[model samples]
Target: MYNSVSEKDWVEAAHPVSQNVRSDIAGAGCDKPYFEPLIPEERPDIDSPYFVYFGRIHEDKGCKTLIEYFKHFKQKSSNKVKLVLIGKNFMNEVDTSDDIIYTGFISDQKKSFYLQNSIGLIIPSPYESLSMVTLEAMIEGKPVLVNGYCDMLKKHIELSHAGYAYFNKEEFCDSLNKLFTMTEKEKAIMSKNGIAYIEANYNWKVIIDKYKYVIENITKP
Candidate 1:
């Protein structure tokens, strides 16, 4: 099985492709076993009201765009929200101040600590093969703001209704504002929607069942 429909299509488009070959796409499963639910005391002492990015601070991942837009959003918006990045700094562009904090690389438990309490997850990558980080965020019941240019990310938001997908800086900033202003009930609904989507689509049990079915079919006499 392929990790994404895009990968499946690309494989099919290769020169001298065989029509006899069949392909199916499945998203990467969440690491729910590693991310055990945290008690309040176990949570980190990080400041509140922040959005998080959970991958490399590289240009290809759209880190530059996310950082620029977030700073822009902060400049105009009165709310004292922040942007927390929880990955290795590859780009070296971030100033690493309170408004845009960068925690080089941290443990999974600490990553969960930040993600579980953040305003939402932001994935601005223009390319992704079914982003595992996005699935992780959703499984944690947090809404996501993803790049609309990435088909996989956009499809996740579309299928799940758990967040927004922005194509440009204006939309990105606007989504940040919207997420910040949402009422508790609205936020809860979005959170619930994300959790339900992840459980139905990317849960390990469901993914394992899919693999079993595929294996059984291929092994049939």
Candidate 2:
């Protein structure tokens, strides 16, 4: 995520990415004070529910894997849950069933709205440096199903208790089943936990203060 590798610099972004990096990467990460964006709803057909994904559709993102997983899930599930892909359709060449919605890059407001309305998020990247959408979904008070293979993101998920992660079909199925079984109140509690983690750890103030202290101590006066 660094534009420069030789020397370090600080950034304050409109979203929670900087906040996450700041908290996790020590003094190297810093932020300017900013208010949190308000969460909005934009999910489609919440009654039947759908699994949402936000990113480029490519092999790295495991689009085929997700498509397969959801296909199996729909077959097993009592409800007809759909998989909504909201990004560039880089995987159009890849053979996938008709159930998946290729939304091909939605706006921020539209994405947030989708996030708000989805049952959960599914991100199964084989290798991901950092997933900003993970933090974004958490801020929206939604639980996600992620690829826990990476130590960094897995650690974040473990620490924050924001969501679940699984390697393959069986584990993913189990996790999804568990999620589907959760009562609305239980889901709400998880959402609350995610929001709290974001506020305390991913908010700009908490991140910026740490930067202030580090800069104060490192000056060449």
Clashes of each: 0, 2
Q: Output the number of the TM-score-best candidate.
A: 1
Q: How close is candidate 1 to the true structure, as a TM-score?
A: 0.86
Clashing pairs in 2: 42-113, 87-105
Per-model TM against the reference: 0.86, 0.76
What ranges in model 2 sit over 4 Å off? 1-47, 92-98, 219-221
Q: What is the C-alpha RMSD of each candidate to the true structure, in Å?
A: 2.8, 7.8
Per-residue alpha-carbon lDDT of candidate 2 for residues 68-155, written as tens digits (9 for 90 to 100):
8777877877776667888887765744455677777767766766777788888888665556677777777888888777544565
Lowest lDDT block of 10, candidate 1:
15-24
lDDT for model 2, please.
0.69
